[model samples]
Target: MLFDTHVHLNARQFFEDRDAVIQRAFDAGVSYMVVVGFDRETIPLAIEIAEQNETIYAAVGWHPVDAVDMTAEDLDWVEELAAHPKVVAIGEMGLDYHWDKSPKAIQKEVFRKQIRLAKKVNMPITIHNREATSDIIEILQQEDAKEVGGIMHCYNDAVDYVQACLDMNFYISLGGPVTFKNATMPKEVAASVPLDRLLVETDAPFLAPHPNRGKRNEPAYVKLVAEKIAELREMAFEEISEITTENAFTLFGIKRS
Candidate 1:
């Protein structure tokens, strides 16, 4: 079985076939998935999905792309939402300098607020970094984020900082990028990362892996992410599945029955 530690089922991209997409994921062996709530509208929608399905779970926080719009009241609302039994984490939040959707200062501020909120709520955080690795690491360090730990969602290639993230007690999650033949860095990082500290995600409705590249991604494709990691590490497919699924379970505090 597989556990996709990150995905966005609440996104409008799946409005018409969301249920079918979820069914495909379970059929594809994705036993669990974290449906992230990265905005006001999706936050409630995410929790709604989680509440309706045992395999689905929610992570609440504002995305850095919308950081400028985040406010103290919003943080308070997220903090409150974190109390839900189905809400497992506090973000898919971090910096995204790849785009200028929000200024760096606001992104950093929002990231920090959510980090503190995660600490306050005793839930792990899920990070999103895009061309903002340096600032993300710095802010994480400054916030002493190791205390709560989290997943570095959709890690592309940060081999040099793998140890740094590990030191902060983060599990490195690989996504579609790892499956791209041209993506040498992510392959290297996937091969080199310790299996115990590795996880797999789909980041659904985005970043679909090779073979399915350029198409809308789905949770079912997490198997491809795990398979790529296995190929990169030269390990058996089943072994990578077991190891990463366990890693996800541990990081997200999901208990096996």
Candidate 2:
């Protein structure tokens, strides 16, 4: 069985056939999935989806891109939502300089606030860093993020950054980008991250793996990611499946039956 550690099933892209897509994931050997919300609007949707499906779980937090419009009330709502039983972590939150959707200062403030909330709630975090590695790391360190632990989702940093996260007890999650021929950094991280600290995700509705590149991604395609990790680490498919699934369980505190 496989655990898709990071996915966005609540996104509008899956609105039409969300049920069918989830069923397909189950049929394809995906035993569990964590649906992450990037903004206030999607947080409840993620909780609702998780409530409806036993195999699904939720992660509630604001994304860096949405930080610009966030108000104090919005932060309160996020904190309340993080208390939900199905919510396993605080995030899909961090820094993103790739898009100018939000001001950098606001993004940094929101990221730091969410990290503090995660610590307050005693929940792990799911981080997203894009071209803002240095700032992200600095804030994470300043906020003392290691207390709760977390996963670096869709990791795109160098070995040093990866090591910093590991030192902080965060799992390194590799997604479709790791399979891209031109993705040298992800490939290197995939090869070097200890098996126990490694996790795999599809980041569905985005970053589809090599063969399925440029297409809409889903949890069903996570197997392709596992295969890529298996290839990179020179391990068997079964081994990759076992170790990564276990890593997901450990990070999310989900017990496999």
Best by lDDT: 1
Weakest 10 consecutive residues of candidate 2 by summed lDDT: 77-86
Clashes of each: 0, 0
Model 2 accuracy (lDDT, Cα): 0.90
lDDT of 2 by residue, 105-139 (tens): 99999998889989988999999999988888788
What TM value does model 2 have?
0.98
Where is model 2 more than 4 Å wrong at Cα? Answer: none
Q: Put down candidate 1 lDDT per residue, 1-257, tens digits, no spaces.
A: 99988899999999999999999999999999999999889999999999999978999999999999888898999999998998999998999998897999989989998899899889999999999898899999999999999999989755998999999999899999999989878988998888899999999999999899999999999999888888878889999999988887888788974
TM-score for every candidate vs. truth?
0.98, 0.98
Question: What's the CA error at residue 131 for candidate 2, in Å?
Answer: 0.1
Distance from true location, Cα of 20 in model 1, Å = 0.6
